[model samples]
Target: MRAENTQPVDRTMDIETLMRALLRDVLGLSQDRVDAFDLDTPLFGALPELDSMAVAGLLTEMEDRFAILIEDDDIDGETFETFGTLLAFAEAKAGN
Candidate 1:
């Protein structure tokens, strides 16, 4: 039998923290707003600041910050339906 090592890998930024920062920076939201974010928090339709234009900017910012490429076809209403969905997409792109 082989023994397995149990060391945790360090990630400079976790998905949730990164997502909150992204929302704050890209949407120009206050820290109070960003701090209230959660997996179930509505994003696209519910948030007044998250319009189509903001979505584009947010995606671009995410690509730059996370060093991940986001394809056109991958974007949709559902992708931004909630914070969780967006985080899932980012996490998948980051191979986390």
Candidate 2:
């Protein structure tokens, strides 16, 4: 019998959902607030809750939940600029 792989697959939708939940949990955002987020939704400067310290916590949660490593050099203003960009960065790191 062949053994099946049990590793988690990083689907686009899954990543999106996870990202939304992460934002809510880490930043103490309301569900409605996060649900309203679309690809073009601005994140960093637009959201007062996502300041520098919150960003650190958010990144740590992202690493834990996504099982990925985020190096200091891997981030820039552009990565957290929008929901799409953040999702793209997560997808790339997750090998989706």
Candidate 3:
């Protein structure tokens, strides 16, 4: 078998980092705070920062950053309820 170290991501950009950038762009939060936020954090209800306008801005930012189109119907609360869920969805969208 080949060595596990042989991979492209090491030389190339990481999707998680890109997702974080998108998050920063959308959420208007610092990178440190974004890193601190975990996978299961209550987004809309608990997080006061995630207002309806902010959510819409985030959706637009994510679509632009990831080079993917998002329909209005795809804007589900569960998708942005946490960092991990959003990362996974972004990964799936970017075909990573």
All candidates' TM-scores?
0.85, 0.89, 0.73
Cα deviation in Å at residue 77, candidate 3? Answer: 2.9
lDDT at 48 for candidate 1? 96
Judging by TM-score, tell me the better candidate of 1 and 2: 2
Which is superior by lDDT, 2 or 3?
2
- Measured by TM-score, how close is model 1 to the native structure? 0.85
- Give the whole-model CA lDDT for all candidates, comma-separated: 0.87, 0.94, 0.71
lDDT of 3 by residue, 9-92 (tens): 532147677766766766677889767766675567666777888878877887787788888776676787777777777777
> With candidate 1 superimposed using the best TM-score fit, by how many Å does residue 78's alpha carbon deviate from the native?
0.9
lDDT for position 17 in model 3: 74
Q: Candidate 1 residues 1-96, lDDT tens each? A: 998766435452476788899999999999999898878999998999999999999999999988999999988768999988998889888888
Clash pairs detected, candidate 1:
none
**Backbone Cα, N, C clashes tallied per candidate:** 0, 0, 0
User: Which residue runs of candidate 3 sit more than 4 Å off their true CA positions?
Assistant: 1-13
lDDT of 3 at 30: 89
Best-performing candidate as measured by lDDT? 2
* Candidate 3 minimal-lDDT segment of 10 residues: 5-14
